[model samples]
Target: MTLEAYNLLGWKSETVNLSFPDEDSWRLDAILYEVDSQKSFYWLLFTGGSISIYLLIYFIQKDSLLKAIRKSRLLFTILFPILLIYIDVNRIEELIHLSL
Candidate 1:
């Protein structure tokens, strides 16, 4: 279901076969907005691709694959609500779709 899972199944990219550990330090990140359907594709492809590729590369080789993913999702779950509050308080335009 995820890139890390795919990596465990032996799929790999040519550019970063042995570089998975270093790549694990990164995650999906972007500047945000209420994207229209057109812009949403970039967000999905880039974010999902980033998340999937990183997971595939990193998790395939790591012993703690599920732990890392759970931690990330947990952190995001805890943090995003506060971010939404900040946006609502300040009336920021970024990522309005998220609150919706």
Candidate 2:
């Protein structure tokens, strides 16, 4: 179950009274807010960088659009799995261990 689903179930349950200490509650909220804001900022930065690079490539290779697209596709295909593996290496290792 997802965090939201779990939270909803907890809310519906009569025994679940989720309350943190006052100082810790504010600190947790602040940390969550900071994490959210940082994620948004990083996402925006990545999007802007991608667009800028695409535009630059488009401008530089105006006549070779097909070649540029092919190169981009190849690059993405090669990098995508590497990125996925990099991000999920821990999960992948856990699964391998479980299987063994």
Q: What digit string (tens of lDDT, one per residue) describes model 2 on residues 19-38?
A: 44555455445434544554
For model 1, how does the per-residue alpha-carbon lDDT over 1-100 read when each residue is reduced to its tens digit? Answer: 0212124356764331122234432321221232233244445445655665566556657657677665345445435444544444343233222322
lDDT of 2: 0.48
Residue 55 shift from truth in candidate 2, angstroms: 0.5
**Candidate of highest TM-score:** 2
Off by over 4 Å in 2: 1-21, 62-100
TM-score of each: 0.26, 0.38
Model 2 pairs in collision:
none
